[model samples]
Target: MDVKKVLIAVDNSTCSEKAARVGYETALQFGAEVALVNIVEPVPANVNPDLTLAPVFLETYDNSKENSDMLLKEIELKFAQGTKTTYLSTVDTAAHGIIKQAEEWAADLIVIGTYGRTGLYHFLMGSVAEHVARKSACPVLIIPNKWEED
Candidate 1:
């Protein structure tokens, strides 16, 4: 398929940085417009069962949005020149935000990173990349973080 638009979904993680690089290179190669997006998950309404955590929840949500904005700007600065690129920040689950942005932008392809979490960790935290790959109408490219020798 002709990839005229590419959407790169990123977070404040090394995996995301790698994905950003890959997305930039791919867009450059394909001459596609790029959209760098970051998702800030809002604090759950039931975070505190006692109903005394609204302030804390609001603070956390604000901080997350601030961080997401910073991350998106950093990624955009690195690869936004010489090509059509846009930066977006949304408050929602990562997979949902990415898919929504892709649909809104009519992206032909989506590039995202996978933390490669498995077992208990993966179960506790659902895989955003997996969800996006399964639900997105467009093709998705998931860049797994390179295993580092510890």
Candidate 2:
């Protein structure tokens, strides 16, 4: 495929860095632009009357956003060896946010990472990579946490 622009979704995990690195190298090899995407996982709304809940909720949300931005900057610097990258951030549910940004940006490829959880853990958490792979109009590549020997 002639990759025009690639979107790479990143988080704090090593898996996310692997995905970003692979995406960056692919963009270099294919002469495509890479965008480092960091989706800040939003906290649930506080509907209760307790005011004490506000602090925890706000702190968690802000930290998520800050962490996401930091991760993007870290990966962008890592990829600076080859790629001139664009970094983007959004606050939302991860899976939907990625797809929406891919569509909005008109990216030709979407790259993400999975923790590779399965069985009960996967069933309980559901898979964001799986959801993006299912819903993305562009091609999606999910880099599992486990490394294949190749």
The candidate maximizing TM-score is 2
Instruction: Judge candidate 2 against the unseen true structure and give its global Cα lDDT, from 0 to 1.
Output: 0.86
The worst-scoring run of ten residues by lDDT in candidate 1 lies at: 45-54
Off by over 4 Å in 2: 47-60, 148-150
**TM-score: model 2 vs. ground truth:** 0.86
Q: On residues 1-150, what C-alpha lDDT tens digit does candidate 2 reach at each position?
A: 989899999888888888887888778888898888888877776745864567778788788778877778888887757676787788878899999999998899998989999899999999999999999999998898895526
- TM-score for candidate 1: 0.83
Candidate RMSDs in Å, in order, are 4.0, 2.7
The residue pairs in collision within model 1 are none
Where is model 1 more than 4 Å wrong at Cα?
45-62, 147-150
